[model samples]
Target: MESTSPLFALRNVTKVFPGVRALDDVRLELYPGQVTALVGENGAGKSTLVKTMTGIYQPESGEIWYDGQQVTIRNPEDARQMGITAIHQETVLFDDMTVAENIFAGSYLTRGRFGNLDWKAMNRRAQEILHDIEAPLSPTAMLSGLSIGQKHMVAIARALSVDARVVILDEPTAALSHHEIHELYELVRRLKARGTAIMFITHKFDEIFAIADRYTVFRDGAFVGDGRIEDVTEPELVEMMVARSLNETYPKVEAPLGEEVFRAEGFSHPTEFADISFAVRKGEILGFYGLVGAGRTEIMRALIGLSEQARGEIYIEGQRVSVRSPADAVQAGLVYVPEERQQQGVMLDMPIYQNISLPQLHRTSRAGFLSTRNELAVARQYGERLNVKTSSWSELVNNLSGGNQQKVVIAKWLATHPRVIIMDEPTKGIDIGSKAAVHAFMSELVQQGLAVIMVSSELPEIMGMADRMIVMNEGRQVREFTRDEATAEAIVSAATGVRA
Candidate 1:
């Protein structure tokens, strides 16, 4: 009972960026009342194609057809007017304004002879949309007062505000909790029922299978294939997206763990977490798992003194240490590679070698002068060791792909010679191939007597890589499991605070 023609279609679309062709005759078709899953690796041009669709960029060549007629989208305004809307991974919203104002920021309801802004109309409509989505939020509430999940609801309402016919959700569940993700799925179903064409872009295979009606694969910026979602298996879809079958992931290297290298005792924060304690041995990989707001990240931040109010006792190499700041933490042989790699990990504007040499500048200085030779040598050694692909050492950190940038951040910390390395979401936004490489490198690192504490939301990653696991729930350490004792079911049960 499906329509023969697509509601929106991009045919033979091409987009070129400088020397690179971002998209090469890529094609996408979104049928009415159907969810099309756009599958791709990290650099597979999904973002580029999205920009074209939302009119952020005009394609080099292609035809965009809507409702059986070709349409020209000149800018974002034009796209919005054409009923095309996008809810990006991190929706750009104003923090200072009310929910209603954020929803109708540019296109507000106006009335009267002078065409004044109609605040009452906007608020009422915003409240109606919020009610329909089952989001209990006030239209006049300040945007900053809302939680991450509530902010996602406002973004969805904004999409509906434009009467969007083509709704694109780009990694919308990246920051959502379990309940929030469920609510988002319901909203997606509601949109589909209204004959809205939805393009769902996500990397999670389970999500793709759960909701997608059709799947379109893209590899290296070109269309690989398209078919019904039920017609393809997970492995087959991955093969299409990556152009090769992936081996068993999480190549955990099992090495002999040595004496405890790092320990946290009575880790407590008044509002964030309470009574959290753990220990990691040298040559060991320890994983922390939890849903959002589980206080895993809060504890990590406090470990390195980002949270001044956090009280904790940290011991390094069997010696009591006082870490008042990240600098002190580094001096105590403890370093953290933060989760927000783009924002907190690497300095995007700096060159790769400079970013790598940032932590250990004293080692790269001779006679009170920065030694470019030594800096480049340190970067070269680690880049080769980590298999970071780059055109040149002088290239800006922003120019490297996600995997290579991650390498640069790790290299920055490795230069510091820390006894314990805490990696928060080490492989969060990178591609599958890069994930394998990072995993292999992590194993290699532990083999050299380094203690690794990895905090990840990915269950498979935690299960596959960690020698021991710790589950957190509602800002408390709920359960601990050795590698032999851990299973997906038991771990999830504890992390979610289920009494089974």
Candidate 2:
């Protein structure tokens, strides 16, 4: 329930960077016991706003008010002192430290004449906080031993230690499992019961609708709208974030399946996946559906020769091939577009053209030297094809937005001209428009007789774009479904090992 008076407020805030206006005259408010969701696409002002609130970056203009009193937070310590703190998607905990130590790291409890550390009191308080949240965690346990979800629980316990009134969670559930997410929801409700004001920054609409009481939307470094969650629809929220009414989020194009292009027989990783037998034909999109630990990505990695000791008999165009390394896989007309595009797919510091032309250096070179003209042409060709929004071909991959960087990754893979292309989580962190573009591009690829294998956690994406799909559960292929046969329930059941 929202109170008449806001617990914290950001009024007319403006923040600017060297080349961009990160935030522009943005206004936001959080009331006691209310869960306020901050919704935005990647590169929106949400991050800037969070930084400003958490004292990471001071606003060039405007004011911050807490409990009806204006305040200036010079650093993170000041923000924490004022009952403001945040938990990021990545848990920040020292591996060598215990849960209790991490919870009271900086603000340690001291006692006795010599002012020695009071570990007993801190451990007791940590246990109380953990019990309050119903988290089954030991305060004396090493932080390194806990799972990702447990680490987040410890972070929440830390917030309670500081008596946090305004707690900002930035993509907290991004890496959490379904069960863990539910646990987090229960913890959040407990926080609300204690009159804590929560500011949730996330791109997931499902989570927003599930937990948020009030909603605030931001677009292009400006405040777009704010309202009660029940008052707004998903499409309306999408419009607010992307500034476009995307009638069709997935542009799936139907194409006739051609002759078999690639096949894997009894592919097995010692511990990852076992006897994964599947085949993809030319002009077909094969979707791999599974939970996080269901071996979807491991199968792809093994297919691309990234997993050592992976045993599989691969066939390309009915001929047996040995994939001993990534080069061998490429030579055998197979390429993988990895999920971690920033770390593996694209060279972040390199120019867009260089990243695009990297795999095609042989074709883009005359003798032993590379041809700049050929490089630029290849980059321009796929850049235009993918509709990458960039200032110039020389723009560094790091400078591009998440969606555009994904485009660059796809363009680089397409440049390889692989017969079998494996795309892992192709649109994981991109916006709807970019996702549609990538979907359309996949359709185009298959239409041109290029076999595609797509590994995705998003059910809607798999159902929308895949011609055929397979569900993996605990290192095994459990079931197969055609586009018409795959349902949310069926796929999820198969992925979770529920024989339905």
lDDT digits (tens) for residues 1-500 of candidate 1: 77879999999999998878999998999998999999887778988988998889999898999999999999999999999999988889998999999989888899999999999999999999888777889999999998777888898899888888999999888878788898889989988888899999988888999999999998889999999999999888878877666564578878988999999999999999999988999999999999888999899999998998999899998899999999999999999999899999999999999999988789999999999999999999887888778778999999887878998899889888888999999988777767777888889889999999999999988988999999999999999989899989999999888975
RMSD of 1: 2.2
Q: Model 1: runs farther than 4 Å from truth?
A: 244-246, 399-401
Q: Summarize candidate 2's per-residue lDDT along 25-114 as a digit string, tens digits.
A: 999999899899998877787777888998999999999999999999889888999999999988788879999999998999999999
Q: Quote the positional error of residue 488 for candidate 2 in Å.
A: 2.3
Q: TM-scores across all candidates?
A: 0.93, 0.91
Task: Look at candidate 2 and tell me the lDDT of residue 495.
Answer: 93
Error of 2 at 292 (Å): 2.9
Candidate 1 clashing pairs? none
Q: Which consecutive 10 residues in model 2 have the weakest lDDT in total?
A: 242-251
Each model's lDDT: 0.90, 0.90
